[model samples]
Target: MLIPFLIMLREGIEAALIVGIIASYLVQSGRRHLIPAIWIGVLLAAALSLFAGAALQWLSAEFPQKQQEFFEGVVGLVAVAMLTSMVFWMKKSARTLKRRLQDSVEHAVHDHPGSGQGWALIGMVFLAVAREGLESIFFLLAIFQQSRDWAAPLGALAGILVSILIGYGLYSGGVRLDLRRFFRLTGMFILLVAAGLLAGVLRKFHEAGVWNHLQQVVFDLNDTLPMDSPLGTVLSGLFGYQAAPVLGEVIAYVLFLTISLACFLRASTPDTSAGAPTGTAMPAVTSPAASSPASNA
Candidate 1:
């Protein structure tokens, strides 16, 4: 539950920020007439995301037991890849995201001139929101398959709701957010989650009979704290905790965390020499339609 909630919260904020940047740029540039187009793009993207998620869920349900395990393993690997890319992309781009967004909007409006401008903006906004939405679906599917608890979806819903509120506050209510700090902390947490998912992926592969080598029992912590216990469930959901992990799973988990964290920390280190920016910071949206601006429309 907590895991899904945090993932959704972070993802929602990212979507909101994109929309906010675009919307703020539009208003500031006196292109407020295109606002409706932005909303239309958002709705369309959301609809598509829902349809895709539902289709995937239905399709997976048709698989046999072993096939299902294989499918889950594949999905888990994909999720890990996507999640890793997302973390690094944000870390690299967050500082300049606003400027880049503003430039793109300016180019879209100016390049297309009058009537065609609206359509161009709509396409842009659609792509932006839809990308985030689709990514969310994939992550949610992976988490849901692993957890299989009622609280998972509920936590996602709550996280999205709270993120919407936070986005709104950041856009219009004059709320200040230290985005650098927020992403840094959350990124670390997410890395841990991803590591757990990696181990789970290996486990799933073994279950599917694809990789059977190194199935040795690394250790047995079930006697100490079983995975099905109340506290254990929470840990398993959030951090991919296991009671009796296999040797391959443990090795994979440790290697993934060590390498991923090292890279993340190195990339995140600030360079303060000369004219370089001293710290990471995101632009503030001070307009009424700030949230809408990120829509690309």
Candidate 2:
């Protein structure tokens, strides 16, 4: 339950932040007429995400047991990849995102130069929101398959609702937040979740009989603390806790978390030695007001 809630919360906040940035830009630039188009794009993206998730669930239900395991394994692998890439991408882009988005909007307006402007902005917001929405759906699907608890979906719904409220607050209520620190902490938590998913993918692959060479049990903690217990279930759902993990699963989990964290930390560190080029002023889009407080909402 907690797992899905956090996942959905992060994803929802990301989508909301994108929309907020675009909307704020439009208002500041006197292009408020295109606001409706932005909302339309958001609605369409949300609808498409819901449709895609339902379709995948329906399709998975039709598969046989063996095929289902294989499908789950594939989906888990995909989710890990997507989650990892998202974390790293957010870390790298957080600082420059405001400027880049503003520039893109400006380019779109200039390129279209007429009635087509609305369509261009609509397409931009649609693609941006849809990307995050689809990513969230995939992660949720993978999580639901593993947890198989009613609470998971409920948690996800709650997270999304909260994120929407927060987004609204950031946009209209002028809420102040330290977005840089928020992304950093969430990114770290997501990396741990992705590592667990990677281990689960390995387990699913073994269950599907695709890999049987390293099936030896690494350790057994089930005797001391059964995974089906109330607390154990929460841990398993939130962090992919395994009581009797196979050797390969343990290795994969450790290696993924260790290496990924190292790379993430290194990438997030600033290069202080490099000085800015002379005769170049920071763009207005990079200004504090222009960037808006909702960039990370």
Candidate 3:
């Protein structure tokens, strides 16, 4: 439950931030007429994401046990990839996000005047929302496959609701978020989650008879901390903890987390080179209002 909640919360916040930024830019730029297009795009993206998730779940249900493992393994791998890329991309782009968005809005409105403007806005917003929505879908799907808990969906729904409220607050100028700090912290958590998912993917593949090597037990803690225990269950859901992990799973989890965390932490160094990209100013830590429209991160 907690795992899905956090993943959805992060994903929801990202989508909300993008929509809020675009909407704010349109309104402030006197292009409020195109605002409805944003909603249209969001609705379309939501519909598509919902449909895709439902289809995948339905299809998985029809598969035999071995095939089910294969499907889950494939989805888990995709989720891991998407989650990792999202973390790194957000870390790199957060600073320039606002400016880049505003520039896109400007181009959308000014580059193609008339009806084309509305279409451009809709397309832009759709792609942005859809990307986040789809990422959430894959992440949640893999999580649900692993935990098989009824509470996971409810937790995810709660996260999305909270994110909507936060996005609204930011847009209304009633909330101030330290995006740099927020993303930095969440990025670390996501890397851990992704590492867990990657390990799970290996297990899934092995179950489907796709991976045969590294079959030896690295350690057995079933009696000490059985997976069925309450604490173990929670840990499994949140951090991919395994009581009797095999050698491969242990190696994969440790290696992925170590290298990913190293890269993520190292990127925290502020770029001071003279070749810094134009309009990539970092927003003030005091308020996202410093960047306008949405968070600077």
Question: Which candidate gets the maximum TM-score versus the true structure?
Answer: 1
Q: How accurate is candidate 2 locally (lDDT)?
A: 0.80
Per-residue alpha-carbon lDDT of candidate 2 for residues 69-122, written as tens digits (9 for 90 to 100): 988898889899989988988777765676888898999899997888888988
Give TM-scores for every candidate, taking all chains together and pairing residue i with residue i: 0.94, 0.91, 0.92
Candidate 2 residues lying further than 4 Å off, grouped into runs, are 274-297
Ranked candidates (TM-score, high to low): 1, 3, 2
Instruction: Give the count of colliding residue pairs in each prediction.
Output: 10, 0, 0
**lDDT (Cα atoms) of all candidates against the true structure:** 0.83, 0.80, 0.85
Candidate 3, residues 47-157: lDDT per residue as tens digits? 999999999999999999999999999999999999999999888887777789889998988998999999999999999999999999999999888766589989999
Tell me the deviation in Å of residue 209 in model 1. 1.2
Two-way lDDT contest, 1 vs 3, winner: 3
| Cα error, candidate 3, residue 18 (Å) | 1.0
Q: How far is candidate 3 from the true structure (C-alpha RMSD, Å)?
A: 3.0
Candidate 2 TM-score, true structure as reference: 0.91
Across 80-168, the per-residue lDDT of candidate 1 in tens digits comes to 88788888889988767888888888888889988878888889989988987888888888998986769999999999999888887
lDDT of 1: 0.83
